[model samples]
Target: AMHPMRSEHIRAAVKRARGNRKEIVNKIEESLTHCLAREGLEGEVLGREKHIYGIYQKMRGKRRAFNEIMDVYGFRIIVDKVDTCYRVLGAVHNLYKPLPGRFKDYIAIPKANGYQSLHTTLFGMHGVPIEIQIRTREMEEMANNGIAAHWLYKSNEEDQPKGTHARARQWVKGVLEMQQRAGNSLEFIESVKIDLFPDEVYVFTPKGRIMELPKGSTAVDFAYAVHTDVGNTCIACRINRRLAPLSEPLQSGATVEIVSAPGARPNPAWLNFVVTGKARTHIRHALKLQRRSESISLGERLLNKVLGGFDSHIDKLSPERVQAVLAEYRQSALEDLLEDIGLGNRMAYVVARRLLSESGEELPSPEGPLAIRGTEGLVLSYAKCCTPIPGDPIVGHLSAGKGMVVHLDTCRNIGEVRHNPEKCIQLSWAKDVVGEFNVELRIELEHQRGLIALLAGSVNAADGNIEKISMDERDGRISVVQLVVSVHDRVHLARVIKKLRAIKGVVHISRVRA
Candidate 1:
């Protein structure tokens, strides 16, 4: 019964009783002593008893009953240094035949919660896979008590030297902050799960430093983890000495380097895929600042353009009076108010009204709100119920909270809103406004294999994005297809309908209306 234990020492006295229950417990305690006495290890070796949750996970994961599983009794080895952890790993590997793929080097990468160790499932003399973990004394301390080591020990002032576990904890706490702002508790818990069980890839920096990140992580994540300033300016990235897409997935052992630009900022779409909290937070922060800057620039441009048309200058409006009016509105800054006006959230005419009243300048009723021309913006929304394009005669309704919602003048709900003039609003598309709008069309075609392909080709020939398509058999000879497609306003809608109608066996094509 004599054997080597990694975290603790199996004492001489316990070796005599091979099958005694109390003696087995004593042997585990003795193993802890042997490991703790080794040079350069720190922390106490308190055998960790398996909790209910841990037992449940093992049983459920293996689809086995509680009594069928073996080796529930395991002892934890606590150490004080990262380097010592590797040495202990070497010692254990030398002593046991580690089951292939059962050895994990978490000491180098660490977990989201900052736990790090060399974990191995080894074939002991008893011919069973016994789990053994080797860790530095510091890692052992963190495992016993989570998140308290930040103040428990006096540490270096350098950012990274505070330990990877501390860094990981800070990152998780930041994620918790974001989750609170998101206001979804379920989503918050789900995000925490993602952080914990992340499928990870380990890569090396050119300088020989190692980084462990979630699998499929991009170079953008790597850049941000290096430093926020570096992330902000990341222009390009190289993996293993070749230029790669910023969104390219990283392998477990690639070498990565970031190429940066001085003034580059993160794109908003980066939020769609980034895995780490550090990268996510930095990208979100950069995007927020960028949006603020963009809004301010847009506002200044619009104010200059509008005032220039009126033969007046923004400076002539008197900053003091503007500030006073803004204070009444509970706005903190003039630029913020101006940005709101430019973004169509706040009407310029309203701000103008406030300004005119405060400055004691007599002015006539304005032509229209800055974005909407009178009842025009109110009555001209493209209704999902009818999906009217530009060619359709559209009417506006004064929808509560939604401002003006437009519908085809002949929309089925027209009677309901028309009867209530209080909810009616005048609206029209400006003469030169140009953009693509979605419209749904119903097509009747013979049951032919090429019909769908032909229709798709015709639609593409006219340049449109297919939003949705579905078909149903009406009978043996015909099928009715619903096509939700986009067009450059009303005139283009006619062209596409005509084209689809020209296809062979296409009997009829007409717009779908409520």
Candidate 2:
């Protein structure tokens, strides 16, 4: 009777009858107490009438007027264990007509935040929907205590029976990690939101190990949810005895089996496809490792490519000369320098120039399109260094027998050539972008495992593929991971990034500057 909307309407009707506000309030209070007493709620039944402003907010969200709202009161029932929670659910069902499809058993799977309950909606005396939640006594206490339950329940919480707590520390640990990687209040809120009210889908592994993930999750997400290493190596997955795509969306009560591949790495594009935090986080981690590997590979190629032009081969470049150069650059060895170059933190041209000078070769003129005789458009061409592409403005460079190296006019490699009047030459795509073109992306995320696989899935979903990825650990817990992917066009890139940022752990997503 004291529910805000109902109470207001009742009081207003009473006022129209020339009844006093003070008398109306008193009468309402007496009626509530009398009803509770009749229900055998003899202990202190503390109640606070909802304020007008509170009711106003609720009405606004619900899009209802004061008179349309019901004055139903809510109560919490606390019991002993998993069994008792269902028992209480039965009791509520017996008392009221249980609303079809409004029942959920979260007690078995639990939420990402360790929230466990059996929730049911029922139609009471009137047709109003009343929500009832039943859980163990300890769940009741934890719900009341909230974050404080981490300390109260401790690490052994899940081990206790009945009234004891469940292992809340594991979820707390995830929260703490997110808190660190979370960039701001909004991002932190989003991360917490995933945990606060996660709808779960339960699946079983081939070994009968049960895994629970967020609703609308996929087979890839389930694979990662089982373990980070398992996610990293998951090549293909099977659902209910049928070989399913990794991006296959999962339903409740399905059996999944992950096919493993040794040395398989996560792809950044996966971020564009996965829904759950576990898959997203693991994808990020795997992408980080894959990025490092790609960086190393690209760096080595650049080093070898630069050295290829030199008259003296790398093996013949004299140990003393190599050692002297390393000492001057303050680097440990050639391998370390190559890794740095691949990482994009070091300049390949500068290092190459230095090595050339050390070999007693005069500095080649930064002129005449670093070209060679008769080596027109058919030679080594950069996939456009600006809008570098197979079908864009290109230029040819003379590089001896290695032939003419073509670059897009807008290529970063050619950006300086326009100012050098002697070197400018118009060029175009020789054939077409015959193979993959590498493009980069920068994504923001909270550090967690398995993020790399989700990113890979995203790329795959967009019809793009990840060639390589690297992460620069930015300060303040946010990571700036770079992905080099093979894409068709800008539209494809945008769609992939949009999907990636929409993922749970992704904070921001954008194209990376080459």
Candidate 3:
């Protein structure tokens, strides 16, 4: 009753359509060329048949239906200046009935990648949609080749002319800034991808300098565009001399002024509304630095308190002992080690003990068990094989330079490192432990709709939070789900498991230790 088109037939159909579009392009180019000659405009007119794959990719990327793609047939008109571009647009509109709302003026507001042009779509022969682009010579070069166009031309000394590549240079500088501020290479790549598509709006400063930002950019983004320091200290803004919210989306031709305060700092909530990569990256970096500074201060206080317990002060330690501790932790300087300790990546007690041992001072015995003050930050790690919670009896193993690893007293992995008694330390939970701990569960269930929802609801009902979830469907009716949930302590976690077991279709559930 039905037949599917073969790949060869599909290719043939595409080729035929391309040929028809090319014919229409030729007709439009001829009309444009004649019209320009009559208008005494000095310009070059060119027509192109877009690649079939390019057209298909664009349609798919934009989620457009087949009949909705209008740029399959394209033309370009390159003139001498911005005014000439407008004149050419006028002539083209007069020649063909331009489609309403299909015109865009990129010349006034260049894209993030520095592309500038005037784009218009028109109804050509047989009602086929034809797309046209008008630009100045420099804009045409950038529109076609982007940043590479700048390097294509050189001055007398084989050097780039000053101000000739200003926009492209600014774009590259922004990319570099983003790379420096990004958390990682993957994040930098994501920021670059966000910057690549430039649906932009042009706004103005009080000085009348035009600034181009991504569509949906807020006053905060505009502040960052003006200067990083301005962004860091921005407290309020005024749009067109009227007080506006910092999160207000900017529109074309609006004059924006940033109000600053010395005490103002970036709020994490701003990340939710910022559209520019520069703003996001800078905000993340500033927050990271701020957190590090706070952690360093906390670590200094913690180290001082711990050293006081040993009757030895951090400042009184010998230079050689301090250098030995620094070398052991691969720290270039004492401040770095302290910052790491403050961030909870390094244990202050561990470093202090090492400093005492190196200085030939008597090391303190394991007189009393250490209390876990959830404030230990990054220096403490719970053993994956044990998943120790606050209520569990835990033992700390001081690994070479990796800091303390806490394990449940009954964990099997404890036996592997038990011979080194010197590395083991007794630990107890504090009266006011502050944060949550992670525990994993493996759930087996009969495949049914809404089972995941029920499982999640059970945990939520029991005051547990799911951190991560993964599912594996085996046969037609069987499935296994793995979940990592945060709990207050062993008692809270056990209650969560009990509630999960009560859900229908749950065949089995057990805590995954390793």
Tell how far residue 420 is off in model 2, in angstroms. Answer: 10
* TM, every model: 0.65, 0.55, 0.65
lDDT values, one for every candidate: 0.66, 0.61, 0.79
Tell me model 2's lDDT, rounded to 2 decimals: 0.61
lDDT of 3 at 142: 69
Please identify which of the two predictions, 1 or 2, would achieve the higher TM-score against the true structure: 1
Which stretches of candidate 2 lie above 4 Å from their native place? 1-72, 80-82, 126-128, 150-167, 176-195, 207-209, 304-340, 343-346, 353-514
Of 2 and 3, the candidate ahead on TM-score is 3
How many residue pairs of model 2 clash at the backbone? 44
**Model 1 worst lDDT run, 10 consecutive residues:** 6-15
- State the weakest 10-residue window (summed lDDT) of model 2: 368-377
Cα deviation at 109, candidate 1, in Å, is 2.6
Order candidates by lDDT, high to low.
Answer: 3, 1, 2
* Among all candidates shown, the one with the greatest lDDT: 3
Q: Can you tell me which runs of candidate 1 are displaced by over 4 Å?
A: 1-20, 25-48, 51-53, 60-64, 68-70, 77-84, 112-114, 145-210, 214-316, 335-351, 358-436, 444-449, 472-479, 489-495, 505-508, 512-514
Tens-place lDDT per residue, model 3, 9-115, is: 43566676665566567777888999999998888998855555655567668898554664446888889988989998888888888999889887776666677
> How much is the lDDT of residue 86 in candidate 1?
70
